[model samples]
Target: MSAFLMENKKLLLDGSVIACVEQRDGEWEDTFICMGENMWLWNRTFTVTDARESWDDFPMEFILQGEVAFYMIPGVNYNGNFWGEGKEPKGLLDDGIPWRFAGHRSGVRAGMLAQTKEAAVGIFAAQENPMGCSMEMERAEKKGFCMRLHFPEQEGPRVYCARDSYEAGKYMETTCFCKKNLVFSAWIVVREPQKQHDYAAFLDKAWEVCREEGSVRLLTDEQVWELGMDFAKNRLYFEEDGFAGFCMGLTWKDKGWEQKRDYLEIGWVGQNASLAVSLLYEYAIFGEKEALRRGLSVLDVWCGRAALPNGLFRCRFDQIRKWGGRIDNDEERNDAANLYSAVTELLEAYHLLAELGIERKLYRKTALAICSFVTQHQLESGKMAKAWFNDGRISDAEGTVGCYLAEALCFGWKECKSREFLNAARAGFSYYYKEFEKYGYTTAGALDTCCVDKESAIPLLRCALELFEITGEREYLEAAKQVSSYLASWQYHYNVQYGGHTLLGQMGYRTRGGTSVSVQHHHIDCYGLEFYEAWKKLAKYTGKEIWRERAEALWENALQNISDGTLVIKGQKRPRGSQDEGILQTRWHTKRGEYFGVSEWLVAWNTAFRLKILRKDFLARKREKSKEEKRIS
Candidate 1:
């Protein structure tokens, strides 16, 4: 520990040792390493205030078995249970590691944790006050992993308790007392010969180095081609309905139960249908029947027997009993909120098949059915009900629904040359366009008063771009650029260090993803899996490298985010560092999901999309080279 601290001090970029510790009215503070002048490199504000008193030992700081050091800062809840009581739930859960909690007034508020013992691997967060902790899994007890920071007392400095720090356009909490806020960052020390779970540490460090190097790498088009192909080729295969049909897809074993595609889940058939276009080309090149077969399976699932008898996409199967079939043998769960996704995916599938010289007769019919359902059920105001059911009760109106389906309608009109379809899309656009005009970038697309989010924003962005392509309307292009610019600000390009783990370079950024929240209502981590493609389209529409640069940055971060499954899963020769699709992880640092199969199941759809994006970049480079060669000649 002594030599580790010595080496750590030298790497701190002007860090100083201060073994000061103190506790007042149950609030704990430890004098973490101090920083010298010019803290702006980290984009953080740092402060050092003389305390009323100091102790020989730093409170809440301890060296575990003379190998690991841990620190827990005192914190309080601005919201959630015990807020009025001036207390918070027991602090547990490390930084960077994710957890899921639910229900009324049940919330976790805490500060950052960083471990820099011999090797850097542990939880970490930045010094952002009023930070709400999301998850404290059921396993936290057995693992002895818990939140170290908790609610500040009823009588602490009002500076840390200020909620007025929230700015209109900013997402992170800022303080007027910038100079008073403590900013801590140091390397976590690590010794060799630890458990395999610790490899997550090594991967994180390697990811940081790669990000710092991505912009400067000198690789040829051939080399880039190879890198993409390697990533695309690493996919898990599966046999469904005896065709060796699908790649690992949306459905995966979760808590011993199979989560399926019926729900139009973000990671399931919806994603697969979108990827089938690329998979067809993959099949053409490699003669891999699985690629073509999976593409067909996507069609069958979206439009064939898997679809509702009434032609609506099923959001879930109506269950009769555990592991039983739908209650009526073919009952459907129709959350009309996502009809746009179903229609758009089906449209893509139809186009790919038609181009490949495959008959899309059935695909076109299913696509039309969904389109007709929306137009028929749509209210005179052009607002579609949130769900399709016998009761016909409206659930919610989200802009995402109108825009996504509108784009599909445009495609439908183009294919069939149908005036009704084009007019229907126009009506949906008029309704959604008003919403956009009213709020612009802040459009949440949800009647639930949701904030503008990456989840809905990405789809809206694509829809706007699609509309622009079809109509050559400046409004559509303007919409795309406005949303793209807003989302770009959401990217986490700065640095964060806690315990001993640091997120810098490319590993610290996520250009393709954004956080989702309903403002003062709630906040949660969200994966913008669809943004990479939308950004690519946006780049082409605008002819700007900024959008293209965002897509490339996201691709790099996606590589940085492969899960450390070796830590939790056993019996694999090595950790399943990356997968072709079974489970989808929302955040980069942890392999787990907010809940459900994502903790274990990898979906084929996710991997397919990942491979497709790499392919896009691959072809992009090839095209650039061809144009450059022509110019040179």
Candidate 2:
């Protein structure tokens, strides 16, 4: 066994220090120890490992002797005035999509630069990893500019996406993953100052050297699942009344454009269409009637004065102060309009619940009325605006309301066999074809800036495929393939932060796969996870498993974003302003300048959506298998 340490007080602020230890032949585990006024003595190992091309249930470990981890060679470095996160990096890349890790929007960030002017390897907070660690860059230090990354033996809770969490400086221990033993891991590529360093090339070379050692072994799928469950068993959100279940949308302090930080003072009195959808899943998952009761309660809240006489739910409850369904606060106008999303979710859930031997007459009535509303007011242009007021006049249409309407009409026609619904859907397809003719597969999103938005694009993609499935129109099927291919183009191929929230480190981010760019909100949302589901369906429709491969890669990356409920994990009711268990937020990666509307808020609906997708995928595959078996027979 061999151990080594390097300390350079001259490299950082007073008391700031950096050190590393390595043993070539030992268990595959590695830890980072950093200390100083500018640095914290934080300990992080690759928390999750065992990748089979993409993230797999089985984690495969290796025993090695002379492997490379990373390097920040101090003595020999070259030119650029200062180099850190680039607008776009050549090796580890993030093209500023909504699926980016938090805080990585102002370009590729969370890196350290050894500036010639400062003569210090200054660690800048790169925001591409999880929110569990923190550092303070104090440029006003009289003695000297100090970049401090302090790690307390016992740190506070993980900060969220709100303004306060951004202001509260700290790191979550579980944010980054690095569970490997390293004999040769250093920071900064050691080379002559002017020489070029090809990170991708070096990484390939490193892997080659290790592979030659015969130390690597593959893991079976069963092993992958066993390992993941082993970790899952210890998670807090799995318990009842866990953090995720409390305040479903926990309060946080959001400092809007104002310079002062203020707490987000809002109580979630229920009545969110999205939450209703989630409760249905909670019932399905745990067979709890209480879950269904909570869901019905949410739907019930929207009734009475909150809804129009026609049963259209208001976007925000004046009494509860929560806005969702199709009408969310992200919209600048028409705070009260009926959304295709709200209508569709209610209709689908009503149908599913009715099948489960539980029927709510009000829900059925409301859903049926929304269907009548769609057919009653058909757009000549074959598209509906994103929102319509109680009077049935278009209030907000720029937000891709048409996409939702298109699907709603299709599903409505299938459910009620309304020729009017089918005609409306047909008209919408014509509009889509015109767009296809003009711009290929990238259709108009909710806004003009994004020609291809995941928000609208997802529904549009599904609409095309569903239309094809329903009508067997070659045109719709062809359109589905085009839209599917275009959506696939926007996928994030790499993680820029692999070594979890550490500067000049490779662990947390630096791992990639999911990120979407469109006119919708410019932040990660669990809804984006649908990209995978869409791809899988397209694969089934187009008869090309290649689409499923793409779906798997994106899904694996998305898995990194899902977190269990917070209440149980954190051990208290979001102590002050931190996350609790059950608040799943796997929408990592954020492009700068997009509205992270409730980006940090717990969205259990996303988990439910994913579960729904998994079931749909499983059933679809089963159906295909049944068909194949029949043909074979």
Candidate 3:
């Protein structure tokens, strides 16, 4: 063990030694370094006193100042820059804002990982702090970049009523804090490079560092599956004079559950057809006739009416007006991600119906038409346009947004046995993988935000794994492992502290395994559900237990805040089996204050994502039980 003492507390890193030294009047810092066989642990604690009488937040900022070649604060700043056009980020959570680059521990993994020429260093904080913490990375001129961890994290370009539409704005002033006495502690790990990139080395230690925090699972898989099915069939499912499908979902306000947005959206948040697939699962597993009828009815409506003339599918239906809706304009254009989702769900629906000896040629036909359009228009570089109108005109052409289509193409290839679909899928994955290698991250995955994000990495991982399975290629398997590190960065490794008054806190919500949405959207969601299967497969293929653990952890996180008929928030009751779309894990402005809570948008995807997973697990367990019973008999 080694200790250092100095006046100006700055962390020092040379090729041989990693240490920090700092001490001043009214401030005391203790630093220790313990060497291990493969990894070294560095511990730091700061004690400080404030003379000010009162303040809203008191912060203790710790710096792992060093000269490093690469640095990233996951889901936030990657290599101290933003991707895309040079324009400033538009929303309250601006991705391009200079210096004000701190993200709440809950919004990310609450750590900074950097790589020097020889080794990888990760600095992570414990999440039990009442005021929360934030991780920031900034370039320090000739000295390289500095990774700063903030306790009671406060930075400027502070936001108020962020993205609220009614009262949204930001300021350049720094968030001030004054507390009489404060103590902050964090753990640091230094390890040798183990993979082609340093991300894995740091992520490995990060998981180990936070393993003690553990996770809490509120409901069993069986209970969750049953509640979710009921919610989908009874509450979220919709029927009208001519149309039968699922509405987007209910929203909460001071009033009780309100079903104001009466629309059947095909993909993204609406997940009408996607949830119907879940209904099919319930029917297949539990033999519920209504589930089968409702599921097929919803799919039938979409398959019959959604195909557009220009070979694209209309993804949204305004139920109130009984008309098809186009995204972003009056034309027939649709966002790439939503369009990909619509195609994928249609393909899945086709598979289920076929298995039941039910002919759904319309479903198969519509999906193939849309996918054929994609393969025909695929760029020479394997890039697909972000959005396209029914007239075959491109709306937006830049960014990795087209990567969303990669998974859909892969599935389409399997169904049709078309080399065109397979080739496009391979090309798209290759292009996006190269882009990620060049930029150190993925971008524009989320439709609302056009900046670096974690969601885009999902398709990359899925495509890589799927390709590896189909072709038996080791290169694709390696790509999946690399992408897993990037995906892991977006997940919360520890349980974040929530204020007692907040809904999340009141319910004892654990942030662990909840994935942050993106850099521009500073919130957590069940997006992890999209890629847990890939993680589980990576574990099986690579024989790495860490990937398996992560997959399980992510499953539990997605189940948080699921309403079991009696779930209530803000003195209002939520429908059973419903779950909010976004959880405000940090001090970000939203409908639910600038603290920990939920956005009250009980999106259909949240329930659908869980139902899909639970249905799979439940059936597997039943199969195992059946085998055991047969053995005894």
Candidate 4:
């Protein structure tokens, strides 16, 4: 034990606090006092004896170094670094490059979680100081991975992109310069591993601590839905070549719209199919003819042109007119998650068509064909490939990408009544859940980043609920509850402190309930919109009010920073219903602007999903209330 471990109870494998005033400097003077069982406060103050004009970036870290365990930095780093020189088993795109970022890069919460067989630990630093926070895992003298939480967070060598490639990244330096005195403090919690090995236990405790400290939620679901629907109908919808759909994304720059032509994508950024489903729901509830026409027309395009011989469809459609309707030579690869989303949305549209007494054969045929092709590709291990070439050849098969397929297959079985789809769904779900049980983390739900991420766990929650609803199985409901815990680990249960001048701060953006993308991407988005229904189902099935509360929290997070058309950022007025794809909760961002500014690429899916859930879940409830009133009258 080092001098920092003054308590009788040992918290870490090698109980020591590694302090670095500079990269080469030795440990700085500090004081540690035990507060409670397995809890302590490390407080220190730096009064600069010799001051320079300014030091923009300096390396100073106070790390609670420990043995390598199942390490996770919420939405930031996952299970150590999965980067190396060669093509390794778990390498991501831009393979062979090392990756790490500042602590604020973590999703809703800025904390690190680590677990050994015997104990689990959570480390967090108050963000009140000028020095930001960051977590790193690298080989040291010890054989295990240690938790290195940096005070005055800094990413050196090169800064990373929160979106895709890091080749264009800028170098960033940490600064604790010019200050007369700097005070830094951190909270550390150590506890025995849960008996059932609940991997998210420490994260839950951290959330409790955060709640005790403070957090904020600013918007309600109703307000968000109204603003979101207005944006979707006015700005997102487009029609060309007899095809109607939502654009992939929109942008406002130099005080005007930047995208000169319409770009349509099927999923991820485009979310054309999902948005179409929302339009159909609007027609159903509000008797809107325009919504019905646009929704059906969008579905018609995919069903007529995009479907391939193997049942998989082309995901990109922007080049359709440019290519004179011939897009076979395009090099675009179809990701499993996007394809799954397309199929799910198609099935939903098919059901709506049937209800409204409209022709639905095309929608049904396309959805079934897609499901059949996906089921045919399942491995003997019950795992599905992550992406495939246009000709049906598997391109990449890794991570929990298959989790999305499982949910899609379950939906297929429910609508199409195919045993193959049902069997495939069950096998796929079981395989992924067992993998989660073993590793205690999910991975690669986002196509752009291949690492442990919260998005992958989302399908497990949906699939579990689907199976439970289909078979009335208690075990599946239990699985849903378990997966919800893992998903919660990625959610911010507290508000992250940001400088008042930053765009997010100006908007009073609440980090509470927003989800971080992947470990490689260090920003928050409304991705939690996908998890809302699963949480609500869990609440209904288990009578757990926490799940319901989480459902609302996730909803609010998804709806934050939405432009009411009057909202402006960087002198550009946001079109009504437009919300940025990324909320820069940290200094790291995709756009080169204010470090804490929102990524102003007003994405269609932001409004697409909000409108979707609003119509499907909330508006459906209101419809039921109206029907009951009519019966009573």
Best by TM-score: 3
Query: How many Å off is the CA of 285 in candidate 4?
Result: 1.4
Whole-model lDDT values for every prediction: 0.41, 0.39, 0.69, 0.69
Angstrom error at residue 114, model 3? 3.3
The TM-score obtained by model 2 is: 0.50
Error of 1 at 115 (Å): 38
Model 3 agreement with the true structure over 397-427: per-residue lDDT tens digits: 7667777787788888888899989999999
The local distance difference test score of model 2 is 0.39
lDDT over C-alpha atoms for residue 225 of model 4: 66
Model 4 C-alpha lDDT per residue in residues 1-633, reported as the tens digit of each score: 122343432344444433221123322345567866666665655555544544443323433344445666666555644631212122112234434456666643346666655556666664445656555554445334445555555554345654543434434454555666666666666665662335455555556556653334555667776777677677777777766777776776566865424557777778889888887887887788988888888888877878887898777677555554454654657887788878888888888788789878777788788889988988999998788877788888887767788888888898868999999999999999888877767887877666677788888889989999988888899888788888887787777677677777777777877787765666788888888888887888898777787787777677666777788777878887787888877756546755777887888877877777777777578679999999999
Model 2 lDDT tens row, 225-248? 232222212221121211121123
Candidate 1, which segments miss by more than 4 Å at Cα?
A: 1-272, 275-278, 307-311, 315-331, 336-338, 390-395, 398-401, 436-452, 501-526, 563-601, 612-633
Model 1, 501-608: lDDT tens per residue?
Answer: 222222342222222222222222223445777887877877875566656655554453344434233222212334322211112112331211123444444444
**Candidate 1 TM-score, C-alpha based:** 0.54
Model 4: residue 312 alpha-carbon error in angstroms? 2.5
In model 2, the Cα lDDT at residue 463 comes to 79
The list of candidate 3 runs beyond 4 A from truth reads: 1-29, 35-69, 84-103, 106-110, 116-119, 126-135, 141-144, 150-153, 157-161, 164-184, 191-197, 260-263, 319-330, 592-594, 616-633
RMSD to the true structure for each prediction, in A, is 15.4, 17.2, 5.1, 5.3
> Could you tell me how far off, in angstroms, the CA of residue 305 lies in candidate 2 after the best superposition?
5.0
The per-prediction tally of clashing pairs is 41, 73, 1, 9
Please give the lDDT score for candidate 4.
0.69
